[model samples]
Structures are given as C-alpha cells and as structure tokens.
Target: MASDQPRIDFSGGAVGYRFRRSGERGHPLVRAAGIKRDHMPSIVDATAGLGRDAFLLASAGAMVTLIERSTEVHALLKDALARAAMESPELAEVVGRMTLVHGDARYLLPELKPDVVIVDPMHPPRRNTALVKKEMRQLSSIVGADEDAAELMRIALATARERVVLKWPLRAAPLLEAPKPSHQYAGKTVRYEVFVTALKPHVK
Candidate 1:
C-alpha cells in the first residue's frame, strides 16, 4: 500500500480526523502556540511535514505559513489544500489562512518574521527499531535524518518575534544544543516545547 499510502488529505482520513477535533483552544499545539479566542499568533511551521500542524493552527484561527523543503511533500500539501478548499466554505476559510512556501526555512525564516515559529524537524528513526508509521517511512525515504535540527531551532529562535515551539515525542531528551524550552505542553504521546525568545511578546 505504499503507492496507495495515506497522503495529506484534508477532506478525509487521519489528517482529516485530527482536523475535525481542532478547536481554537484546548489542544496542546494550540496552547503551545498561544492560540486564544482573541490572540491567534501568526505562526510559521518551519518543517511543514504533510502540513498537518499548520492546517490545525489555521483551523484555530492563526494565519500560518508552511515551509517545506521537499518538493514532493510540498506538492502533496498544495494539491490537498486545493482539493479541500472546494469541499465547503468552512474548509475554504481555514485553507485560505494557510500559505505554503517551498524552500529551506533557515533562509526563509528571517523574511517571514512570524510571531511564532514551530519546528518539528525529522529525527533519525530510533536505532534498531522499525519505523512502523507509514508517514515516517515516507519521510525517511525522502529526507532521511534531519542532521540540522539544532541549527534550525537556532534560526527559528532568532527569527520568531514571540516564541518558538518544538514538537517532540514524549519522554525523549530535549535538544542539548538549543536553549532549553521555557516550558512544555505534554499530551499522551507527544509534547510541544515552547521557547520564549522574545523579551516582549507581540500584542495587538
């Protein structure tokens, strides 16, 4: 089923299922990104794998920019977004909030200057363990282990106006090279680690 593998479909399937549960509040990514009824910070998903988190942020009312370096992944996101926009007015509204960019985020981050930057760069799959997730398999086949995660985090912190969020697996060690996150929002299997890089958070 590799060819028939689940792609990023906002209309239906796992990505769609999660999108349905996304609200303006309550979700950990929502909290970590400081998404509220009145304050939906502009966010940049530095590693826009499949565009799922970026879509969720848009659903919660934030203007999100997604940067994907991989051309194939970017194409998948673009096609899914186009198809989803035609599904309904509600879906269109959310899709409209997301802007997709294809390039290396390290260079693009400075120009975007978002209120928040979210980094979920790929990690080398755990040693000696199988990558059982289809998406991980696809990602590994495409991008391999992201050796520059620390560098990306450093750039994100420098570029973001308010803060940077790192999406990581629960129980994994934090990146030692980057400044420790100011705090973290943990879920059942993953966490959003927030690093407050801005001394004064941008407020409207």
Candidate 2:
C-alpha cells in the first residue's frame, strides 16, 4: 500500500465521526431514494466505493446491497463494515441492513432485481483540484474513472423496479448518454438525479 492510499476505516477516525454525527435521520438521499415508513426500498448501490452512501441509507432503514466491482475496494469495504458493525449496538444494527457483493453491477443488477439502484460513478476529475479532498483524490487513484458510467445508468434504469438515483457533481453537466432525470435533489457539492422507471407507479 502507498502512503497516499486512503484507509477504509469506518469504525474510527473521520468516517466514523461523520456517520455518528449524521445518525439514522433522513438526509437528501432518503428523499432521493424515496425512503418512507410505508416504503422501505431495497436498494442496490451499484458503484459502492467506500459505501458511505449505502451506510447512510441502511442507517435510515432501507435494506441496501452494496456492489463494488474493484476487488481491493470490495475487500476494504468488507473489512470496514465488519469492524464498524462490532464497534457498537447502533452500528451493528445499521450494518445488519447492508449487504456487500463483489461484482460488476452491470452483470448483477438483473439478478438482484432491486426496487431502486444507486449509480454514483466517480465524477471526472474537477478542474479545480483544490476543492477535492485528499481522501477522495487517493480513492480516485484506486478506482480510476468510471468510463462506462453512462452504460451503467442505462442498465440501472432498465433494471430498477422503481427508480435510479444518480449521485453526481452538482456543477457538472448531466450524462448526455443517459435519459433525463425525472427529479433532482441538489446539495451543496453533489446532487442526486433520479430517473423513475417505466415499470409501474412507485409503491406508496
């Protein structure tokens, strides 16, 4: 491992602190994924790198399956989740709601048949690198760029029973190759672009 490689430590340090502070409340993602008391969606996080988003969703009561294609990242996430789960009662409960799969989502989406799919392909490197976090930069080197992100979105749109939520850089242009999002939830840095599937009306 290199000095620049970001350690996947979910139970301690910054990640743990953030997850602890965020708690199990509904953030923008809860709304983006349409999580409600009557509607706890089964979500497949297709590009679950560090799985921060998946952890957040699981904490919010959704059953989340995190799919990480990179072998190294998958291993890191697996260890981190296990370590985090043993840290406390609350974390254990949240980790119980998450499932990690080591595979490419393109091949696994149809088989999983989730109600919602989250495609957060790493965004292209920003021109102004000053704003990019050191951890993010290190993670980028591990995963590289998501060149097939457009295709991933198309497949997710076709597979999800309800919707596909795309986490993207708010300032960047939307994926032209993918269909227009049915809705958008904008945060300070990133946004969740939702594409409602044609499968049927979302369950209330």
Candidate 3:
C-alpha cells in the first residue's frame, strides 16, 4: 500500500493534498471525454489511485465513484474528501454526490452500472518524464504499477452501459482492440479514446 503518500488539509478540512504529480491540473484523457456539464454521467473510476482523475471528473459535473484497492490509499482518499468537504462547502456538496469504495474495482464495478466507466492503469513512466509530481512520485514508489490493467479494462468495457474510456499515453495502443473509438482527444503526452458501446436508433 502507498503509506508514504503525503496528505494535507485546510482548516480541519481536506483542502489541498499532494499526489505524484501534484502540480498537474487534470487527466488529459478524462478531459477529452467531452463530458458536458448538463450531460454528466454517473462515472466510476476503477483505478482511483490518489483520486486525482476522479476528482477532476467530479469537478467536471459527473457523479463519481472512486474504487481503490490499497488500504493506505483508501484512507488517504477519505481524508482528502473529508478535508475537501470541509474547506469548500460547495465541494462538500459534490462529495455528497460522490462515493469512495475501498476495494477492488473489478469486484465492485460489476454491481454498480455507471453510464461511463473510466480506468487508468498504472504504467511505468517513460524515462523522459519519469519525474512525476511529488505526491504521485511518493505514492507510485509505494503502490508500483497495476498488474491487472488489461483485466480492468475488459471489466470496465463490459460494465459501462454507454461507453468505457481508457486513459493511455498518446503513443500507446488501445486498451482493448475491439470497436475502435468513434472519437478521441489528444494532449501533449496523453489522449482519451471514446468507444461508443450503444447507439440510439433513429426516430421515425
């Protein structure tokens, strides 16, 4: 478990915390999903990690469910959520809309049918930008890489009703080789691949 990950708070609330890449703003893939403020889906971030991407999704208007397997990570995530709730009352309202489950996303995701499921398997950082955010660096040193990334991807694709999105390096291959993405969003180092699972039939 990532026991050494740094945790911070503001006024007895989870205001700001540190992650491997603390200074980074958001997940490139998640941002690329093109989620509209009003068309928010119920999202489950299977690999919650330090909850950075999950937090970003929530901030984007999706009701997020974060599933974490590491006990240490689970604890820190709760603390951060609580602190975030306390610091920003508005965030607290958002927290009310979110849920954190301290368990494997594989087991939990099946029971919760979200409109969209997001997974970001931990991959080894390229030697070039291996230098991650301080908080992420610490946590990564402890949590290591996700051994079941492929499996998680499979599960997410099956579980999501509308779509399953995978966040990967811009140069990496698709998580699953089935149904090529109907759309994609590219960033400097990463991108979001949107695989549309079902389509509404045309109305007569």
Candidate 4:
C-alpha cells in the first residue's frame, strides 16, 4: 500500500529495515562523511532528497542542515522528521539535530558556514528502470536531473570549511574536477567523493 504521509519511521518499513541491518558505526555513509566519536562535523546536505543520508548523519551525532529546493520533497522530509520525532525518544534526539531548510542551496550556502557540505544530486535515469525503487522513480520523474549540480558543488567547495563530499553512482564521472587531491570511499553500488577544501586553518 502507498503511504499518504511522508515518514522517516526508523521503527518500521524500509527505513527501519535499513537502520537495523546496517551497522551504524561502520556504515560507509558515516565513514564517507568523516563522522567520528569525538568530532561530529556540522553538515549541510545540499540536495536533501529523501533525507536518508541527513538522518544517518544526525543519528551519528552530527548537526545536519538539510536544504531541499523542491517543495514536494521538502514537505515529505518535514513530515517525516515530525513523525519520527513524535514516535520515539531516540529518533526525537536525532530529529533535534536536523534543521530543515526550504530553498535552493546555491542561494543559502553563502550564509551557512558548515564544516562539511554534502551533495547527493539526482542521477540520470538508468536503462533498467525496474531496478530503481518506486519512490525514487517518482522523485526523479518529478524533479528531473540536477543540471546545476556542478554549480552547486562549486559553491559548496567555496563555502565548506573542512571538505565537500559528493555521492554519485559507482561508475559515473564526477560533476567537477578537484582542485586538490581527493579521496574516494566506495560502497557496493555507490561511492562518495571527498574533496578536502581546507579553506579554514583549523579544518584539520
């Protein structure tokens, strides 16, 4: 059955399943975001799609600011966060760490100086469409590809204090060439490209 309400339910459904199945400490997303026990970097998720990665970062104790340009997706994320906050004490704590922003990140990034800026722009549709999840398919159909992803990345790189992380398909080319040497953390189907901006002296 299709859910009428957008939910970030960590207790049940696909989100819950993923939460239980993935080891939080060793998850690739956490590793890629440079999450540590002592130092959890403030992250700006520029393309906060389903709020999955932002939620993960929040759960790991990082303060996350999610920016969603699309009104529909932003509403979904907002509803999900609200529901999750009401449902469980643990989830409420995580929700508290997340700040939702409705606007294009390009316009907002200048004012917010976060330690890490994470960009997970929408990928182009695959040839085998059946492999994609239904919700993702719907989102892609509604939002289309992020043609301005490179511009967003440029802004992120300029604004981020420590680094700018980009999540892309395992085989896809990067949106922009790195100014400095970058690192890669590969998952089964996706990979995170880490560009160390080090714009601030205290970044290390």
TM-score per prediction, in order, is 0.89, 0.89, 0.79, 0.88
Candidate 1: regions farther than 4 A off: 1-6, 21-24, 124-132, 200-204
lDDT of 4: 0.81
Q: Which candidate order results from sorting by TM-score in descending order?
A: 2, 1, 4, 3
lDDT of each: 0.83, 0.85, 0.70, 0.81
Better of 1 and 3 by TM-score: 1
Off by over 4 Å in 4: 1-9, 18-22, 127-131, 200-204
Screening candidate 1 with a backbone cut-off below 3 angstroms (N, C-alpha, C), the clashing residue pairs are none
Candidate 4 lDDT at 154 equals: 91
Q: List the residue pairs that clash in candidate 2.
A: none
Q: Supply candidate 4's per-residue lDDT for 34.
A: 84
Q: Against the true structure, whose lDDT is highest? A: 2
Q: Candidates ranked by lDDT, best first?
A: 2, 1, 4, 3
Model 4 steric clash total? 0
Query: Which lDDT value does model 2 have at 79?
Result: 89
Q: Residues 29-60, candidate 4, lDDT per residue (tens digit)? A: 78878898887898999999888888888877
lDDT (Cα, 0-100) at 99 in candidate 1: 95
Q: What tens digits encode model 3's per-residue C-alpha lDDT throughout 95-188? A: 7766899889888888998888887777555444433556656767667778888888778777787787877888876666776777877777
Deviation in Å, model 4, residue 56 alpha carbon: 0.6
lDDT of 3 at 46: 87
Weakest lDDT window of 10 consecutive positions for candidate 3: 11-20
